[model samples]
Target: MGASIPPPPPVITRSSDMDPHTLEQLRAVKEMLTAQEEEAQGLRDLNRDLRERLEDCETKIKKLNEQNDEYAEKEKVLSHRVAEKVRNNKQMSVVMEEYERTIS
Candidate 1:
């Protein structure tokens, strides 16, 4: 949140002695109000920009997570294929040994 605005200056009465300084005081107060308003607006703009960046980051994370899941599934399929190949090789080795025994 931005800085809180100060309470407005006390209302000036039309007494003769205080009359001279009233206009000066009014001008000073007006300038202060303007400055505060500008600061608050700048903070609002910064907040909005940060929110947009966070949303972009979240979207990117979602895409990467989905890609990772696909890779994991592919790895499972390849592992099964390798296991099957190893079993087939063992069976062939046993058969070759039996054939040599018969020939000898």
Candidate 2:
């Protein structure tokens, strides 16, 4: 004849065996988890705001760079004009000196 398998042990319940300290610790853990969830949500909102601000700053910087290029082009044109004026003035001074010497 084959041997039979043993049965599993039965569970025992006792309402009087509950520990008060363990219950209090469980409640404290739940409160901590709730607080952590709220803090995480706040951080997410702040990160989104910062990302939007960074995009705005990037757009402003691009516009300023375009304006700076326009100003640089204008400056180059003015510089060329000033150089021509200086050349003309030097030539006129030499001509005046020659005239004075001839007249003396």
Candidate 3:
């Protein structure tokens, strides 16, 4: 087999050697990247704020649900008491009617 050839030397290029158009393109690319980074940072901040608001809303909803449950239980108890009073009133009316009949 033939001997392997040595690799070519590395081409070192200085910034001064780079053409003006190429340098302008690089600067434009850098500016675009900076703008994109700023936009991304703003989005991240907005996302954090939205997350905080969502957490607050969820907490409020949980508290409201608990309060609703307590109110429902109180309403049920009150309804039962009202029903008991109605039954007692009906019984008293029946006894009063019997007494009136006996007097008549």
Candidate 1 to truth, TM:
0.63
How close is every model to the real structure, measured as TM-score? 0.63, 0.69, 0.81
Worst 10 residues of 1 by lDDT: 11-20
Clashing pairs in 1: none
RMSD of 2: 5.9
Model 3, 17: alpha-carbon shift in Å?
3.6
- Candidate 3 accuracy as TM-score: 0.81
* Best TM-score among the predictions, by candidate number: 3
* lDDT tens digits by residue: candidate 1, 1-104: 99999999776576454665776887788999999999999989999999999999999999999999999999999999999999999999999999999999
* Each prediction's whole-model lDDT (CA): 0.89, 0.90, 0.96
lDDT of 3 by residue, 28-60 (tens): 999999999999999999999999999999999
Please list the Cα RMSD from the true structure of every candidate, rounded to 1 decimal place: 9.4, 5.9, 3.4
lDDT of 1: 0.89
Say which prediction, candidate 2 or candidate 3, comes out ahead on lDDT. 3
Clashes of each: 0, 0, 0
Residue-pair clash count for candidate 3: 0
